[model samples]
Target: MTSDREQGTGGDLVATLIRTAGRRADPPADAYRAVLAAAEDTWQRKVGRRRHWRVGVGIAAAFVLLTAGAALLRVVVLPMMAPAEIARVDRVGGGVATRPAGAGAWVPLVAARRPLHAGTRLRTGPDGRVDLRLEGGVSLRLAVMTEVELHAPDLIRLQRGAVYADTGSAGPGGIVVVTPAGIARDLGTQFELRYAGDVLRLRVREGRVSLQRDAGELVAAAGEQLTIDTAGGVTRGNIARDDPDWAWAETIAPVPDFNDQSVAVLLEWVARETGRPVHYADAAAEQRAASVILHGRVGPLAPLEALGVLLSTTDLTYEILPDGTIEVRYQ
Candidate 1:
């Protein structure tokens, strides 16, 4: 009987232990709540991280668009703004304008574009002193009162002036002075041209200049001078000598006639004198001239003096050169 009682006690103890083990294997209610809370916190943190990353990317994209738009606006809108003040010079007596800080006085042989930029000014004196300061350190001094139109980045029109151009460090086509006779292209050097009566004088100081005309072209070198007449004559000389004709005819050729035939004939004649071919790019330029006759051999006083004498004889406009090659054209 005693043995049976012991077995029953053992069985009951084993059953109680099994039930306690099963309850321990399963989590408590409070433990389940704690695990759920941790899961929720972890999910919230992941969502917040994703949202922050998305916001950062959005901001970066927005910044890029803003920058690009600003750049585009600058390029599209800036050119339409009003022009800034480039230069302002006081007009001196006799239509001369002086730069506040420059080497010489400047005069416009022709009506010039106003509000010139820095380094360009007009200077003149009634006693045969006129000049234009082209950009690139070029100063063109005239022996006669003259006028010129200044067009920047490479164009100048000589209305009426005897000019000595000294260019500084400018490239080819950097500056051009257009006269009634033709066009002078500068190549970072010094040169001079005078239109007096039917004569034009050209002198080269440091570099070469291309004097282009419908009838001829002349490439002047440093230290060389030439002259020409409206009657198709030419003369070449040195610059050191006193230019007597320039003094007398400084005020002579006040106007340039673009329609004169004598100028073209003179240019062709000058080409003959220079031993170089004068080719006309425009075929009509050769045929569109009226008859204007000139007399005298091509020499120092040949055509310049003759032009002054025959100024009223024919309706011819003259372009003179220092090498004694003159071109007369119809005005």
Candidate 2:
């Protein structure tokens, strides 16, 4: 048998060993819980960072798109809404006045080179004459006691009186002249249209014109004249291109720009303005005309007067024949 003291001591040692073994066999549950919690926190933080980055990128992209769209609207949409320019009041002579679209007050147009827009009504006094430089290389001359309305760049309304039009060589667009009795469409021509007390007259100097009436449509070619009465009866006749009746139009003709232009070109312009054909005396005169350059201003003279001034500088002389031919000869 063993003593009591030894037995107690052995029992104590056995108990200590058992406790140490239990501690080693199982880890603390709190430590495992803390590690799992830390992992979840780290994952949540990473996801939040990614989401914030995406939201920031999206906002920036939206802002950029909105800015670009606004810029595009400004550049593309505004111009189309602006009104088109038709013709300008190139020259105002005598007593010229205008009544704005709907207004009754007649504003005296003392200024030259004023711009005329659609719906503007123009009236000239008995002594008044106005010249208009239309768009597309077209020109118009309004005679005395005339009333006209600019409907658009390519359309005009002649209430009363006469107007002359010249569409240059480029053939930009057909100009429509609306009269009380009929409508005249220019076919790349120089022509005169007159409207008075139930009578309409059309004289084509060059090219052709188409006249439309309620009764029928009539085509008038160069050197042709047509008269339409209030009864819609048509009377056609032949008229000389350089008829003396066209002299009033020449009085307000625009002076040709002669800077570094050839004599031949100037002579051709004179011929057109005077409603005459240019005739060179011989081959040498024609060659000389083609070769010689003209310089200087013609001042504010009529076409014939300006022609006289221009030819004085060269060794050439010209005469207007009885049949309206401008014969150019060597001095």
**lDDT score at residue 178, model 1, on the 0-100 scale:** 61
Cα lDDT tens digits for candidate 2, 118-153: 668889899998888877667888999999987666
User: What is the Å distance of residue 189 in model 2 from its true position?
Assistant: 0.8
lDDT of 1 by residue, 1-331 (tens): 5554676988777877887778556776434533443344346545865576567666797765665566445434542453223322211224454442244644443333244643344445565344334444444444436654443435555556666554544555556666655567776665667765646777765577887655678887766787777764667777532244333322322222223336455544333223223443343444543244444433232234434445445554455545543444544
How big is the positional error of residue 214 in model 1, measured in Å on the Cα after superposition? 0.6
Give the local distance difference test score of model 2.
Answer: 0.80
What candidate 2 gets wrong by more than 4 Å, as runs, is 1-83, 170-173
- The whole-model C-alpha lDDT of candidate 1 against the native structure comes to 0.50
Best by lDDT: 2
Q: What is candidate 2's CA lDDT for residue 121?
A: 84
> Alpha-carbon error at 92 in model 1, in Å?
7.0
| lDDT score, candidate 1, position 226 | 72
